[model samples]
Target: MDTGGGMNEHWQGVAEGLRDDTALLLAVQAEYRRLYERCFRDDPAVNHRLPVITHAFRRLGRWRVFLLLTPWMLARLLVPDEPPDIEIPADWRPAARRGAPYTMIGPAFSLELLTGRQKAHLNYSTAIGHYFLHPLVLAMAPFPTPEAVFGAWNDVIAARNANLEKMRRQNPQQEEISRREFFSGGFRK
Candidate 1:
């Protein structure tokens, strides 16, 4: 099914946008780090929150970046944006058909043609990535204002990292079990 001329350009634009967004996210993180270092030296609470904020920022940043980028990659391989238009036979008339009309469904996204298993796999991966990244962005955000955005960002990262590290150190055995489980099924479950 033909997706028309706009498909390629649309996906290309999306890919570029994703790349730009990723860069912006990284830059924002760097700025947050610099500010944290310069300003929050003596405060124990701020120190405690640093890793959390960074981890959260990285997580959300990574997922959004992936979400924005994956479509382009899949579009390149499976759909090619300009697929040949399907031609209906001259004698074929929908009203004359005995059964339901022949429905010609074109590609909405690259994954549409994939097997159920493959679609599930891709969806699972996307979900996992999003889960990791969304919180980071959320933590970093200074909601409802332009002034304390950076501060909010830093606070979230610091908090996330601090908790993450503590969890890591506190539960080595659990972590090992989780690692095993995670790898055993590609974390699909």
Candidate 2:
């Protein structure tokens, strides 16, 4: 799908990727396969396996940055800056909410489409999700609506917050120290 000058911007590096069989993409794809297997470890009674799905992001053109930041700014306005005052049982353990599945990965960002979650930020993210969800077919695709992705992502954030709470309890004194540091402009360079 060339768009005048060359390949469509959305599929820009893909031909090169396919031609060279990028080792990193291959490795990322393989690791996802393992995680996909783990997600269904309890389903030994079923002989069939789930299909892997792949997707690509639609091109954003000149409106990309505006599209990205508008929601972030709006969300910041809607959500207060102050932290919430809530309490949880000291012995409570984190549990997955019904039908909410997640995996923890180190944050990824890439300036170039060939690397990082920035690749997804700039392109159709179904390719990225395909590895995690293990869909059987991967076709040229577009990024889904932000609500579709981030709404579900709230679950992962909740899990992270629970773990952070546990850490705060374990090291209660550090909480005040960190708070003071933040309020006093002690950001690390």
Candidate 3:
């Protein structure tokens, strides 16, 4: 089925749901920020060589600074001089470029969108969700509302759940096939 309108409708539904669950959203967002900060700091050096380490450190340092400054910047805009709702841990630092640590920023952001309390701060979430649902919104010039923007998001979730069910149904059969192959010495090459 054509999911264009449905995708946008899903986005709206998710956004509305988040707005209704503001407290939970805030808590989740706060947790995400902390996780991101931790990843940035705990990243290991990609190479122990001094030159590579230096280069990676420089890049990571700049990224770390930007990440560190984000909360302060948001605080200034949202509540001047007030402490940020989320606290950056003492150990928080940027990940080295060489190590390229897998920061869970994407999932954290998704969680924020899933649980955000304020619609005004949803620009980031909307943008990210829009990208994910790009297929549905590609033909539309500008999505009418944030809800419409999330239509693709809902489609993705439905698709994922369906896939999981299909996998579960096929897994037993696949396991049996594997066992038969093993017993038959099918690996002889």
Highest lDDT: which candidate?
Answer: 1
Query: Could you tell which candidate, 1 or 2, scores higher by lDDT?
Result: 1
Residue 5, candidate 2: how far off, in angstroms? 18
lDDT of 2 by residue, 2-99 (tens): 11222222221222232222432443345345544766445443222332222232222211111111111111001101111222112211221113
What do the candidate models score in CA lDDT, each in turn? Answer: 0.31, 0.30, 0.28
Q: Residue-pair clashes per candidate, as listed?
A: 19, 11, 13
TM-scores of all predicted structures: 0.28, 0.24, 0.23
Model 1 residue 96 distance off true place after TM-score fit, in angstroms: 33
Order of candidate numbers by lDDT, starting with the best: 1, 2, 3
- Model 1: CA > 4 A from native: 1-147, 186-189
Tens digit of lDDT per residue, candidate 1, span 12-62? 111222234445345434433543455544544332322312222222211
Q: Per-residue lDDT of 50-140 in model 3, one digit per residue for the tens?
A: 1100000111211110011121111100111111133222222111211334322211112112224221221122201211110122222
Best by TM-score: 1
Q: Considering TM-score, where higher is better, how would the candidates rank from best to worst? A: 1, 2, 3
Question: What does each candidate score in C-alpha RMSD?
Answer: 17.3, 18.5, 20.9
Model 3: which ten-residue window has the lowest total lDDT?
Answer: 48-57
